[model samples]
Target: MAGGGIGGALGGLIGLACAVLPGPAPIAPVSSVDTSLWSAATLERGRQIAAAGDCAVCHTAPGGQTNAGGFALETPFGTVYSTNLTPDRETGIGTWSYEAFQRAMRKGIARDGSHLYPAFPYTAFAKMSESDMMALYAYLMSQPAVRNSPPRTKLPFPMNQRPLVAGWNWLFHDERAFVPDETRSAQWNRGKYLVDGAGHCGACHTPRNAIGAEKGGFAYLTGGSAEGWDAPSLVGSRAAPVPWTEDTLFDYLRTGFSAEHGVAAGPMGPVVAGLSTLPESDVRAISHYIASLSPRVDPAVSADAAAAHAVRASAAQTLDDEGGRRIFESACAVCHAESGGVGHFGVRPLMGLNTSVALATPDNLLHVLQHGIDRPATAELGYMPGFKDVFDDRQLAELASYIRARYAPGQPAWRDLESASARLRAHAH
Candidate 1:
């Protein structure tokens, strides 16, 4: 009797799992796309949408064809390669019908009805308007197709089961369309839509749970990590010594440099590059929306005054560590020093005002020191040479500690610098 009861309970559990595991039927592939069906305006709009989404940044591999895919994304589960977005019959999405594309973008389901990993950001794309989605589809179909198939994403054990993604979706995915708040201005609404939808800013800036889902409510845009670099918080708790205003944010997003903050680095470098193609108005809207979320600086304290104060604080601690001071003066001060004049990149970034120095962790500062900026946000902004080969673990740690002490006097000192530097170096290799 006991054996029979156990078997019955196991069978019930299996039945429940089977009911939820089935996915949508696969859509038949098309022979060729009819480009004439889409108007020129639609194509242009789609191009803008693609830029906002930074699609090419993720889809294109280094030195590879645009939108042909092969860029590998490292996640907690494993590496997932981006798929080809071009209109190729075999390897790309050329055979995909508009309906199939729509489902994939909004539902995280492929044309063949397989559950796509959320790493594709379909959860965010689902909020985009139908017109915008169609425009993107039209634009992609019009691009030059490359016959390339990216490596299939393979995870260990039970994670290899794509059907399990359905459960993840049920738990975390929100497919509701964006509704503009009537109280807000049109510009603000537009900015919010772009930021939350196509931009998917939270994907990088928001903290995530153990299951890899972004934490919402109080945790939205409270800072996260991407490609091993810290994506600083965009909310009231921003790490930059100076609070960001709409004007500053606009300049940063449009030009990839902010006089009061710092240049875009890490994964943010690609995002800024993409934003450079957008219309000034759209950029302004985005800046406006993001600024609204941040707490305003004291009205009595002017930005210039605040900057001067920070510089003074950093300078006060310059002599605290002789070893670190020597390294900074010898290796970094030429461009970063207040009186160093214009750097090789035409602009000398003050370390005191840099966001990397003020961040809660030394991750961004360490990354910049080790890898440098091979590609500046813009060509004219100039490049930074990495010190990976120049500095050993001890030197790297000392330099980082000195910079933090000098620049961010109020924040707690970063611990375990030597170990952190060693770990980052190993990961880079």
Candidate 2:
């Protein structure tokens, strides 16, 4: 009787495992899709959607063909290579039918019925409208086919199991289409749809749980990290010394620079580039929606007063860290010094007002110091030369500490500067 009972229990466990293992059936491949069948308007809409989604940013590898996909995305689990989006018959998605594409987007399942990792941001894509999805499909199918097969993602141990993703999906994936709120204005709703769906801003800006699912509810869009840089909060908790108005946010998104804020750098450079393709109305709507999340409280000080305060603070700290001050004067003062007014580049952003200095951590500032801005958002903007070759870890730390003290006087001094600089330098190489 004991033997029979043990056997039955083991059999039941095996049955349960088998039940979850079977995924959806593989969709049949197509010989070729008729690109001519899609309307011009549909293709244009698809292009806009792709830009909003930042599809090319992930799919296209450095110095690789556009959409041919060999980009390596580093994640907590392992490195995942983005697959080719170009419609090549052998190596790309040329054989995929609309059903296959839709399933992959909405369900995180591939054409062969294998589960896709959440690194693709399909959770956000699932919220996209059916019309938009269709249009995206048409646009991708219409692209020039390139035969390039990206490296397959392989995780270690338990994570390597594909069926395990079913459980992950059950817990995290919503798989629901976007529903507009009736109480909100048309523009607000439109903005929400784009932000939540194609924009997937939360993917980078929101904190994630232990299992890698994005933390929602009160934790949504508070702050997160991407590619070693801080993705600051979009809400009231943002580190910007000055509150972001819709106008300022729009300027930042539209042109990648706001005089009150700072220039877009690091991972955000590509995001800003992608946003530049969007229409003025759409960009405004997104800015408006984001701005509404963080209502500006009156600072009660005039701009002139603030500027004077920063100057005084900066001057006072110069004595404390003479070495840092000297470095800044020789290396950074040409453009950043108030007395100079403007650098040779014709734009002068006040250090006190820059977001990087105001941030609680010195990560962003260090990154800028190391990498510099090779690609300014627009041609008119000034290019920043990296100090990686010129400054050692000790020097970088000193410079960052000095800048933070001078610009953001109210904030506590950052700790572990040398360690932080070392870590950033290691990552760069």
Candidate 3:
């Protein structure tokens, strides 16, 4: 588990909605024409929560717009766009009642009775409480209605079909609401709720089986293969040059940085930006939440206790051809060596990155090495150069193997650069 760091759950409920095109699907939910529960306070809170969730960032495409519903999400399955959530009677949800709206957010069902794809994150949103869900509904209703109809979706072949989705839901969806554990600290439990619910971090952080359900046991946020990007692990990650402390995590969520780690980049960058604007209490809660995930210790790392870390770190200096030392020198040492580099635009070291040594494999490492992620670009953000050109496949493979072996501890080296290269090629369209 991220243990006090977020995996940047979700934003716009972007996805395919095919029920009403020529003819609606049978599962399409008919609108419930009721308005008895639309409360003003709830609507206001919903708007605030929506902002915290960064709904517009994904739902609204570039150019001045509000719920225009056509921001294309470039996934491994081609591209998907944001849905029309405004109150337009036709193109938007003008006809949707509070119950219908709540159902869509919680159940991945459309007001018109269609099963929403998991791309909308109803699985994660389902963890939200009834009050919070109502607030969200109010916020959506308050938004300006756009009559613009989005283009029809074109998912790749079999995945394009909807029936296949029911099975996917059966495998992944958990409808039970979050029930706090009293034995744990309130903060810890809060962290748990956020991680499992609002943070929904596991949807991405956890690996999936061939059928795409989250691999039930150990693979659960120990990290896994994501479609467009390799999901990094949140397990006893010591990825930051400094230790992964709550205070440091607080800084990263608030400012998108800590002295040791890179600013949020890739898919996480946008989510970080969303977090930076959230309430400190919520951020702290999220931190607390991440900290409460299932406990673990990297057997290979030798330093189970944080206090023992320095000793283990010292031992790293003696890494002869160990994965840690070799990787540090080859790709990471330049920026990470005490004064070698500063921030990501400069260098963040590999000594204690949880992101580095926590995973069972090198997908994240390979991605960073092969693609060379830097802090993603914001208006004032700096750029990170892609390093696919700098390191060849063999070197990346070696470096990845080296880092994972050294930091991840018990895990055996499993990546072959030749194989990694071949997979990259295979993924290419």
Candidate 4:
């Protein structure tokens, strides 16, 4: 009797383990929605959500049919091609049921039961509310379907196996939908939902672990690099030249440029463009939430820090080299040295107060020199041409070093500048 009881107990334990081992339930085809039945307001709402999510920026390729994806997204492991989100019968999600779309967004599973690579940012999307998810679905399905097949993603070795992604998801994914903080005000909660869920700001702003999953909690939004440009910290120890005020942050997010900071470029340009379409309240909410993340510094404290930084910069200027000085005087001074006036192409920025110059890292400066600023020309803003063609690696290094010495005195002189310049130049072309 004792032996039989032990055998049953062991069997029960094995059964329990088996039941809990599987991560998410196997996905099935969701019931299709009748597009005609979707309300016009719902469709419009979906359009706004999609814009906030910047879905089209990643999905649409340059000169390609909108939503017919072909853009190559570079990752540490390999390049991942964006998929065709358009509802084409053969090449796109035309056959995808609403269930299938939800599974992909919330569970990172493709319509065919294949696990999607995290490059699609499903990890962040997983936190979206069910209603918003459905609205996004409606909007995507309503778009005109284009029969364009983007190139297949070819990852090397073990990463090529779709089954491996299942393990990755199990390790990093949180299956719960976003829950609001009841203690917080409605506006704050709205901002959190927009940024943490659909906007997926942390996808770029937050650092990742070994598996490319976001490092949440205390490390969240403390700055991370993406596609060669550093997305500076949004919280503690803010990196923007001038400390961010709510209005300034809102303006920057809404217009893509701030008088205090600088214009958005690279990946940020598209984000700003998308945010421009969102409601003024939505943008203001984002600014409010971001500002709330870090403690506000006293004006005197900020002034002291600035003064110290300037003193260090002044001391370092004494060590500037003649070659770099000559280069700056010849090429950089016309715009940079003219006091109380706009920069080249009417850009309103001061290098001394610019974060790119004053920041500890030289990467942002390198990026600007290599690629330059090219925002859409408007009555208010102008463009600055890149200097990659004119400046060789050595000369560029000298110029960069000189600028750092003059504008950001206390920062250490950059080493391995030649190598950095070479890499930037190679990638530029």
RMSD of each: 4.8, 5.5, 8.5, 7.5
The alpha-carbon lDDT assigned to residue 179 of candidate 3 equals: 91
Q: Write the per-residue lDDT of candidate 2 for residues 1-429, one digit (tens) a residue.
A: 244543454355345545765667889899889999999999999999999998999999988999999888887767888999999999999999999999999999999998888999999999999999999999999999998988888877456766667767876889999999899888888888888899999999898876678999988888887877888888885477767777778888888887766677788877888888889898898988887787654434424444664476457443476778889989888877766444387356667877788787899899889887888866667788899889999999888888888788878899999999999888761
Task: Tally clashes: model 3.
Answer: 27
Clash count list over all predictions: 0, 0, 27, 1
lDDT of 4 by residue, 286-357 (tens): 988888897875545655554554444434345547888898777766765534333355665556656777
- Show the colliding residue pairs in model 1: none
TM-score of each: 0.93, 0.91, 0.68, 0.86
Best by lDDT: 1
The model with the greater lDDT, 2 or 3, is 2
Error of 4 at 57 (Å): 1.5
Arrange candidates, best TM-score first: 1, 2, 4, 3
Ranking by lDDT: 1, 2, 4, 3
Misplaced by over 4 Å in model 3 are: 1-44, 51-54, 57-67, 71-81, 86-89, 144-151, 155-172, 215-220, 235-243, 260-262, 294-336, 340-354, 357-361, 369-381, 388-414, 418-429
- Candidate 1: global Cα-lDDT? 0.83
Instruction: Show where candidate 4 strays beyond 4 Å.
Output: 1-33, 297-319, 337-346, 375-380
* Cα RMSD, model 1: 4.8
| Better structure of 2 and 3 per TM-score | 2
Overall local distance difference test of candidate 4: 0.76
